[model samples]
Target: MISIWIYATLFLGFMVLAARSDARDLRISNRLTLTMAASGLAAVGLLGGGAAALLVAAATGAATLAIAWVLFEFGWLGGGDVKLAGAAAIWLGPEATLAFVLATTVFGAVLAVLLLVLSRWDMMLEMVGSHWRTRLTADTISVPYALAMAPAGVLAILARFPDLF
Candidate 1:
């Protein structure tokens, strides 16, 4: 329980890097998320119950690496987002990851809708459309979506896995 605060601080440090960096090379988000997942468990383990925490830590680490290779590299999603999500999983563990993912998906969808609704079509065209016009246009990145969804995921995990807490 107290360990959750430590994990949150670590995650926040990652966010600071993401906000400060002007380029994509830093991979601030990806690494941060991964750290959150792996360390979150280990920290809990420090409170005792080593076996489950270590198992989750290992599995989440592997999954984070795979995600980095695919999603982050492909630019489908940011590295920080990937890493942060994984870290949150460390706190939630395997059984809760699913619910957390579902929460993230739904939260992301709502955010996307909100962004679309807030902007007029003409403005949208000017912003996203121009980028889309380019054959290799990168999708518009939303730090808030990732940041906001992470905690929501954590809550979702907690809700689903009360025993873990």
Candidate 2:
């Protein structure tokens, strides 16, 4: 359907853009984030269901952003991760977004536990390194945490709603 097509386009485009943002010479700013945020929400609105559905997505998305902010404030998250969380909210709605967050949390926790069992906390620490109480330099950072998981969540939802993209 048209919705699926749009969602597919948006998903692919977002991934490409995000990846591009990760390039060595690229520079991301708040303006770019806002533009992407708008587009990302629109994609969710059109692809997920409708305006009504988007309303749900918005609420859920806000919750996701709020939680991310809290974590970020505690030096537990990155700005990019917060932005990704908000972007996902625009499409997933609250319930779906919650599902995404829960899934990501479980995934991350499992990964962490696995790392610990393997005695690789030091490696895991390297990613966020000595920043549990403060942020690292903005340069040379990976993409946001939510971004890594958002696609998986969206894909799972799309699987359930075959009509969606």
Candidate 3:
């Protein structure tokens, strides 16, 4: 149980860092995604249900990847976002995966609204830094949806390790 807590903490920490990076650079590193996926597998294995967990994780990841690929083809999401979401889904499993998706969808909408409002104010945009200002103001830039992804991942982790509260 304690080990699970530790794993959950680590997972949440990395997720927060990924969200920060995505917010700042619009990119989620493959290294971070891989680490998250590995940690999730390790944690699941520790639960004494390694085989079933692995299968569930694999299936969830494949499903997420398929959905993400379609979204990517439609130019709605970036490759990094796809990879990050798929990796996180391995941790979330089937039960909580739907919650993660719903959470991400809600947060994405909120982020879009906030960015839209921020883009309207020159002073606010300038304060966000030149790179972000340009992206926020650009007509074609994609939102760093990983910000929402991280929070959803954390929520799913919390659902699994409820006692962490």
What Cα-based lDDT does every candidate model obtain?
A: 0.55, 0.57, 0.81
Rank ordering of all candidates by lDDT, starting from the highest: 3, 2, 1
Local accuracy of candidate 3 as per-residue lDDT tens digits, 119-161? 8888898698778878978986568998888888778887766
> Model 2, which residues run further than 4 Å from truth?
19-29, 44-51, 106-147, 150-156, 159-165
Which stretch of 10 consecutive residues in model 1 shows the poorest summed lDDT? 129-138
TM-score of each: 0.59, 0.60, 0.90
Question: What RMSD does model 1 have?
Answer: 5.9
lDDT of 2 by residue, 63-117 (tens): 7788889987987566766776677556555555666677767655664454344
lDDT of 3: 0.81
* Clash pairs detected, candidate 2: 56-93, 57-93, 60-94, 61-89
How does candidate 2 score on lDDT?
0.57
What 10-residue stretch in candidate 2 is worst by lDDT? 132-141
How does residue 30 of candidate 3 score in lDDT? 89
Question: How do the residues 23-64 of candidate 1 rate in per-residue lDDT, one tens digit apiece?
Answer: 333245455555555556666577456787678656865675
Candidate 3 deviant stretches above 4 angstroms: none
